[model samples]
Target chain A: MKVRQVSIFLENRSGRLAGVLSEVAKAGVNIRALSLADTSDFGILRLIVDNVDAGVKALKDSGHTVSLTEVLAVEISDRPGGLAETLEALSAADLNVEYMYAFVCRVTEKAVVVFRFEDVDAALAALKAADISVLPANTVYAI
Target chain B: MFNPQAEAMPREELRKLQGERLRSLVARAYERVAFYRAKMDAQGVRPEDIRGIEDIVKLPFTEKSEFRDQYPFGMFAVPMSEIVRIHASSGTTGKPTVVGYTRADIDNWAECAARSLGCGGATAEDTVQVAYGYGLFTGGLGMHYGAEKLGAAALPMSAGNTEKQVMLMKDFGVTVLCCTPSYALQIAEVAEQMGEDVRSFPLKAGFFGAEPWTQGMREHIEERLPLKALDIYGLSEVAGPGVANECLEQDGLHVFEDHFYPEIIDPETGASLPDGEKGELVFTCLTKEGVPLIRYRTRDITLLMNSGPCACGRTSRKMARLMGRTDDMLIIRGINVFPSQVENVLVRIEGVHPQYLIIVDRKGNLDTIEIQVEVTEDLFSDEVKKLEALRDKIHYQIKAMLNVSAKITLVEPKTIERGLGKAKRVLDRRQRI
Candidate 1:
């Protein structure tokens, strides 16, 4: 299952991240999981929000370059080696994870991780074959 | 000391020679080039009226734009069969400003270049390593032919490959280096990095030009490399690198007045400024046969000093070091880069705003240009690969167009500071003369 992630381009300057977060908050969107990739010149802000379309619109209207990306959400047991175990399957399946971030679910003792893979379909197939609990867009958004 | 008779000619005799040359040049240009004919006709002036150097004011001023207006071969006074070589420099637009030379013209250029090199202490026994980029740019071939003309062995080491440059310099016993001032320093830094004692090289002198460099840079270069750093001045439109040179006196560059006559004019009102007063520098090509120019506005700001004879025995009027350009054209790494050219590239790419900021700085003896472009919503992608691709596209296009590599930084839409009226586009931080 694929989840839509809102990613905004941020310049590596003072208060740039805060400015984007304020724009998302003003749009009345709740952030699920977020990760920031940065270089010396600029940064890429990858965000998974409860409502992707509204968050993107607010950022774009505020003159930020925003785009939508499809990432996968996987549920795992909240344990010492939960991420390690999930990663071992992807490595064996030869699926490359471009990036990943995690968030603990309040409704259960499980953790939800958002992943961007080189190939989403291949990653989804591998996760299914591994019998991992792959959550859909609605289930992740509700959490 | 090369061509001593001409280089040390008295002012009275030199003026007579320049007057005769200018008279013939106008006649040839009026009779051949239709663009020159029209401009002269529009000014209600004819060739016969320009009988002497004093009558130069009667000729129409040829602007740089006229060169672009008369594209490929429109400005050449001679037929295509007579042209032996063609050189082009970057223009304000996509097309370059083209210049052509006949056999005699090439010979004259070689002689001028040789004289320039000789002024900087080059002799027939010296081996010159021409490090300026060859091709459409005139710096490399210009110096190469000059070294050959001077009877010195010419090493056509066209720019880059720093390791090879140093290796060849040591192994071949290069006595003279010819390139932009910044690049000469770059070579010295590279040599030091390679564990070579930079000052131990046999390089005696260097002719640095094609870009504006300060006296401080010259001193710095001399300190790093054991050589007499001399400033050579020229433009492709004005017959390339041998129009003027500093004759070891380091006072001012002596304009080869017998060939290319110099004048200082008010940049705003077009009135001639007196000697020693700073204004826009203009030149009238007195001996050019292919594309003879009459009072071509050079856009270079400098003054002519006619005070007595120089200690080096050259009697030609000397021009002070170039102050700056009257236009927004930035000379990065000896390449002419117009802001509008960058703007043209930006506008052509979809979703890129025409507004851009060009930041030019000197990074470790080399010029660095950084272009800050605002990223539009239509151009951005969530994936880092796609965003990087967009940045690479801009970088590649700019490099292709300007012939100079630029660091492109894509910023948030409103992050770039907008000016009140005309948004300032260029921020030059380089220490230039």
Candidate 2:
């Protein structure tokens, strides 16, 4: 129903994002999925890591500002109109998706899209009512 | 209450006394200091030309660079034998501005500092904690002597050692806290971290000076520590921390006009501006014998509050809190910008901390300013659009207020350097022509 996403603030300078990723890598934490939201001056690198505590500690030890966000990861069909169908259900429920990113699963014909909604619990209940498959925290980390 | 007679003197009588002091100061400067004599001769204005305080404009304005060029003891009116004490303030460039004090000068400074403390409601029963750094800097000793002269218990605690400072405040029952406003904030933070309620302490008033602080910061300190935060203004070149201070009314700082004559002048043309007009501040040491400066340009930007006498019954004129310094003003795209204006906008906005850094640079044909704002945990959002919206809001407000387009950069919390003495606000990287 919810996944813990690690968000690191990266200044728009060369090697800043690389430095952040390397900090987590030095702690032997595996990154499952990641998305970068950027502007001309700065960027926010959001990641779904296998070991949340280890990754956070590594980043913190390296003096990087890291934030933990609870986002919903839902499984949709890989075919076209899959996202549009899920979005239509969400629109019917009036759940607002603040921002979202996705990653494909090689094991199944489904794709996991991470969504940051205004209300996590409300979004979770809406997806459940719409019969959408919501991936659990453990499943997202393992995938 | 030390020296009530002088503090509350009638305006006309004060003016008369100021005129007499100015005449003596000019005569002494002309006879003793070669610098003053040469400057006066070049302007064709003799010592007799300045018969009253009204004729102060006849005196040549002394720039800060002149003090540095004179160096060690060239500006001293008295010989080294009569100079009992020496203090120097660091200049922006070159040699530090050195000042000497005779025994009378020290006593006068102490009297002024005592009067300043009295403005904040200090008395013989109060214990003052001087947390401003001691030695070389004038803040610590300046306030310490004032506390002593006021018949209050003086605590020379100098700066740093936060936990101990709080403990001493609790144990020794310090009634008055003296330090920069930022340092007071740091003390409050340390007290809270130690699980000690500073408001429960017996602090009645605080004298915060040496740097310009906003009204918001004053409220923050007062709310946290339960003390009347008063602004104390001074410069080592004239006399340290006791030059002027805000009385209990908290309207404006009452300048000790008899000791230091205050005047406002247009920084551009060096023409005298009337009271209540915003301009550069120039000070003339009226009775300073050791180092008598005649019409020394301070370069601080402020307006003289022309309102009637304060409610506290002091007839002395009050000066508005400093807006900014002339040197601190940055010209970007043919517009003058002050860091205080940027700070004014930042404090009014929600989710934005007052701590920020302004970086100015030249990009080819135009000047560029980049404002780096710290993103607090409460302001941080997972959505990129929300963060960008925050940046845009800051950009729009700055553009609307300052009329200068700025690049707003959101950085992580605590990334900008914070100086305990005076927080560094501006960084100019432009190539000097």
Q: Which candidate is the best by TM-score?
A: 1
lDDT of 1 by residue, B318-360 (tens): 9999999899988888888889889988888774564579999
lDDT (Cα, 0-100) at B102 in candidate 1: 93
Question: Which 10-residue window in model 2 chain B sums to the lowest lDDT?
Answer: B329-338
List the candidate 1 regions with Cα displacement exceeding 4 Å: A1-4, A22-29, A50-63, A68-100, A115-139
Compose the digit string of candidate 1's lDDT tens values, residues A1-143: 69998888899989999999999999999998889988777889998889888898898888888888889999988878988889999999999888888888889868889999879999999999988889999888778
Report the lDDT of model 1 for residue B384: 74
lDDT of 2 at A110: 83
- What's model 2's lDDT at B399? 90
